[model samples]
Target: AQSVSQHNHHVILSEAASLELGCNYSYGGTVNLFWYVQYPGQHLQLLLKYFSGDPLVKGIKGFEAEFIKSKFSFNLRKPSVQWSDTAEYFCAGLDYGGSQGNLIFGKGTKLSVKP
Candidate 1:
């Protein structure tokens, strides 16, 4: 079994400021990492992911993450954030490289951006 950890419980920022969310997962074998976001009342959306090959990966809406195998960390970052980016961010991990079952999720980090 694997476990995910999000060190940031809550973050507050102004529009256009940079943002970074830390995510760490514990697993001995090969694992897949993800960052998911949810608006106030919307369902979870995939922000970014890492599997193989590139350690640095980019995703939709100007979001990116770097996968550090030795540190077991996959941190999410955005150069500039918007008020619309305000949402709850979750870190998840799968023991294997496949998404066959439910993802082990960390308690979400809530981001509130001031417009």
Candidate 2:
């Protein structure tokens, strides 16, 4: 079965630091990619997504991700991160045909931004 991978288990940075979270997907066919963020006590919110068209898509806030089909990778990036950006990031994958079913999420990356 295809899966999403987030290599960073935990990330820490001071406010205003740059952030880049790596993500990799293992789907053989067409797939949809997404990045979701969950605040300390809030529900998950969609940060960005890529279904088609441009491989480089911008998400809410300053978050952005680039889809590299050849490498089956969709990595999230932010030139600068703030304390308010502290949250759990999840990279998700959904088979285009099997979507409507469920979203396969990564193990989750906990980001801690110190003020």
Q: Estimate each model's TM-score.
A: 0.93, 0.94
Candidate 1 lDDT over residue span 1-115, tens digit each:
5789999999999999999999988887767888999999999999888888899999999999999988989999999999999999998987554556568999989999999
| Candidate 2 overall lDDT versus native | 0.92
Clashing pairs in 2: none
**Could you give candidate 2's per-residue lDDT for residues 94-114 as a string of tens digits?**
865543647899999999999
Reference-based lDDT, each prediction:
0.90, 0.92
RMSD of each: 1.9, 1.3
Worst 10 residues of 1 by lDDT: 94-103
Could you tally the backbone clashes for each prediction?
A: 0, 0
